[model samples]
Target: MRTIDRRPLALAGCLFLAALCLAPQTAHAHLVQTGFGTFYDGVAHLFITPPDLLVAIGLGLLAGLCGAAASRSVVFALPAAWLAGEMAGAFFPSSLALPWLTTVSFGAVGVLVALNANLPRALLVALACGAGLLHGFVNGSTMVAAGTDRLGMIGASVSVFLVITLASGLVVSLRAHWAQVAVRVAGSWIAAIGLLMLGWLVRGQG
Candidate 1:
């Protein structure tokens, strides 16, 4: 009796495994789902998105540099403005995408942080509000395209509140000169990254 050929079976199994490994996976461009709900998804989106996270952190650092009073204002104002912006974007979705706005937002904030600028309370709040509105609007439009609900935006705003509160509080609590300098260093790095992103954007457009 002829022995069964085991080599052919092994080859088939290897090819099947390779095919499985090379299979394409589904990707979500805008929303990130945690299986909990849209709310958590929104929170996850804020942390995962580089531009949004960078701007949020930069704003927190700037507010902390300003003073405790300014931080307080930012902690509330930013989230509120973000929610409002999201609402507007959801209601009036625009086809135009402004990726450059995000780069500029974080770049400007990062520069301010590096400078350790002595910004007035009003100016700080204004900056926070402006960043919130712009970023939130972009997020809103993306979420709409992704079929995510408003709850996600609210969740994102909530995350922003917590992030700002913690980040600003940490900076305000630091008494060491070196610690402050370190924060500024981080700001400079953020600015450098933003510049790099801007260059890439220009290259892509070109």
Candidate 2:
């Protein structure tokens, strides 16, 4: 057998080791860095997080189904409640993790949307506020753990406002019965996803 060239193999191994040493360390999984600041990172976080996005979409769809007044109320109330909850959470950090709360929240909102339930304005606002508080607390705790600035929370709340405004506004403008039905169909899909996630969670726990 021909003798192997040990020099090339040694060089390759050395380069690989060097590369590993130079590699950047892993960042926090929950926080996204946009190179623009913590604020933009917070803004991006809402879009990237599935549970939060689903809740926002469910709330928006429900508000839209109810009408313009409900949409307007949710548009403002959700973000405000989110900010308040974030502030509270930041002041008093907790180790409690309630992933199930998010699943239930989005699931219930989806059910209401699919049913086309004629929820009163006050009730709709209350639902939006409740969801906001729960999600906001989670986000706040996450931010604190990551050592992110509070401005990120403000950015996240702003993003919530934008998302709700867009989603609810689009639904409110729909006049056709079929179009409304389509919205309800989307709600059903959201509910289905929530159920699937809940099942997975249960399975994992078991």
RMSD in order of candidates: 17.0, 16.4
lDDT of each: 0.84, 0.85
Best by lDDT: 2
CA deviation > 4 Å runs, candidate 1: 1-29
Looking at model 2, the pairs that clash are none
- TM-score of model number 1: 0.84
List the candidates' TM-scores in order. 0.84, 0.84
The per-candidate count of clashes, in order, stands at 0, 0
Residue 2 of model 2 has an lDDT of 100
Q: Write the per-residue lDDT of candidate 2 for residues 1-206, one digit (tens) a residue.
A: 99888998999998885554333322234888899999998899899888889999889999999999889899999999988887877888665445667777898998898999989999999999999998888788777877778899999999999998999999999999999999999999989988887787666540
